[model samples]
Target: MTRALSAFLVLFGLIAPALAAPQNKDGDSAEAIDLLTQASKAVRRETYRGIIVYLRQGDVDTLKVVHRYYDHEEQERLISMSGQVREVIRKGDKVTSILPDHELVLVSEHPPKSMLGGMSHFSPKRLKANYQVVDLGTARTAGRDCRVIAIRPRDKFRYGYKMLIDSKTQLPLKLNLLHHGKRLEQMMFTDIAFPDHIPDSEFVPSYDVHGFRIVRHQAVHVSESASDKREEQWHATNLPPGFKLAEDGVRQLTSDASVRQMLFTDGVATVSAFIAPAGLRAPLKGATRMGAVHAYGDIVDDTQITVVGEVPAITARRIAQNLVQEKNTAKKAPAAND
Candidate 1:
């Protein structure tokens, strides 16, 4: 997939170890769960603006974000403060990205709840099975007193997260993505403000995109008949503990080609499995890692199988290796251009 398309899909899709602090014995787990639940709600229900620093691998970038929640709908705009000049505007599910360096614009539909910070609706009760939530005491971020919380993985199949939530507004001020006690990626707000009212003009792009090359990715929902057939044709026989199939459908990337996708999640972590016809491009064999995101690919029954997620490399490989394509269920579709 193109970088823009991958980003759009992945959005519709990490953290660090904690310092030595006294763990609360009483009400710690319950408090951590409550805090996380509040933070998730705050992300969608509050209007705020801030400067965020995003670090992945060894590179860093800065962004200015303006978010507004009104009438039960959310709108946000992010402008690059460092590196290439770019902007992203998200109103509900439709996302418009403006790349000034390339003079390109990408318009695509994504899940409305997907945020640039990667926080989404999650079930605290369900997450308990695979991750241990703990209150890591207090810390300060963005000049606000915050409560530190850690969601530690029970096994190596998944990663961990450390969050510093504003004590007053319950907004997440900093988030760290961790693997094996090492940091993979980190996003922290350098400055933030919760405003009483944010005008609509704040969400508009600052640059004129009238002459930029525009690419639109349309999502074609599968018919009921096709969806039933898809369920029978693809499945993962072996999945890690607590992981369940959350979404399954076929997405039309282009007019002539479609890809079958199945999304699996353990409440806190998610994995996506994609199946497209072979020869669309060179198949992505074996495994690869881009920061915290791991992808594994293989070929099955003349189809290309790629499993991608922000989980461990082994988790992606296991999911890719266990996919089973039923025989004679349906004919292969047209190849998708990656």
Candidate 2:
């Protein structure tokens, strides 16, 4: 599945240690959970606007974000403050990305919620099961006192997270993505304010509409097959522990019905498998690595299979090389009456 998370990862994305953290004598394990839960809830319950400094390697981006929820409806706008005039506006499930540099307006439908939207779907119980939740005391972020929490993974399948959560509001102020003891990406709020009310005009796109091309990605022609058939056609016999098949589907990208997709995740990390006719898309020769994201591709039985993820190159290659074309025995089997 090409999700909002993957789109975000394509531009910005990490792993951490597998060792468990030694907790302090006075700290309770559940306190970490409570703090994370509060942070998740605060995304929807509060209206805030801030300047976010996103850093990945030598690339740094200053983004201004305004997010609010009114009458059960959520709206958000993110604009690049440096470099190109790029912007992404989201209202509910509709996402509109305006790239002034490219002079193109791309529109697509995304999920109602995403990890970038402060994942409310993230389960603390699942996190505890897959990681070691550590409370690292307190610090100051965005001029507000914050409680520090570090969620380190127990295996190589997922990434680690360190967050400075606002003490009173329970909002995240500074977040770091770690991998193998190194920080790969960082998100910190320089200045932020939670308001009693946010204006609707803040969500509007003030970009020039004249002479710009608009592409409706939401209207893409995709013919879907049964989910069961998709599962039968593709199988990941070997997967990292704690990772599971989150979603799978077979869909025609255009006029052909050979394109298939499968999504796997360990809650913290996600990977995508795309299978299609060899001639349908550009064949990935060997492997490519960019920052934290990696992709590998190969041709099997005259079909192209590509695996992509924000993971180690070894992990990406392993997933790509292990693509197995399992026969759909369920659909081929004779009926009970037969």
> TM-score of the candidate numbered 1?
0.84
The parts of candidate 2 lying over 4 Å away from their true place are 1-28, 111-126, 219-232, 328-338
Write one digit per residue (lDDT tens) for candidate 2, span 181-294. Answer: 788777788999998888888988879867889997532222344444554467775666565666665554565445667776665677888888788766786798766678
Q: For model 1, how big is the CA root-mean-square deviation?
A: 6.6
Error of 2 at 242 (Å): 0.6
lDDT of each candidate versus the true structure: 0.73, 0.67
lDDT of residue 324 for candidate 1: 75
Report the lDDT tens digits of candidate 1 across residue range 205-252.
888888999998765344465566644468676687667776677776
Quote the positional error of residue 139 for candidate 1 in Å.
0.8
Compute each candidate's TM-score over C-alphas.
0.84, 0.81
Which candidate number maximizes lDDT? 1
Best by TM-score: 1
Cα displacement (angstroms), candidate 2, residue 310, comes to 2.5
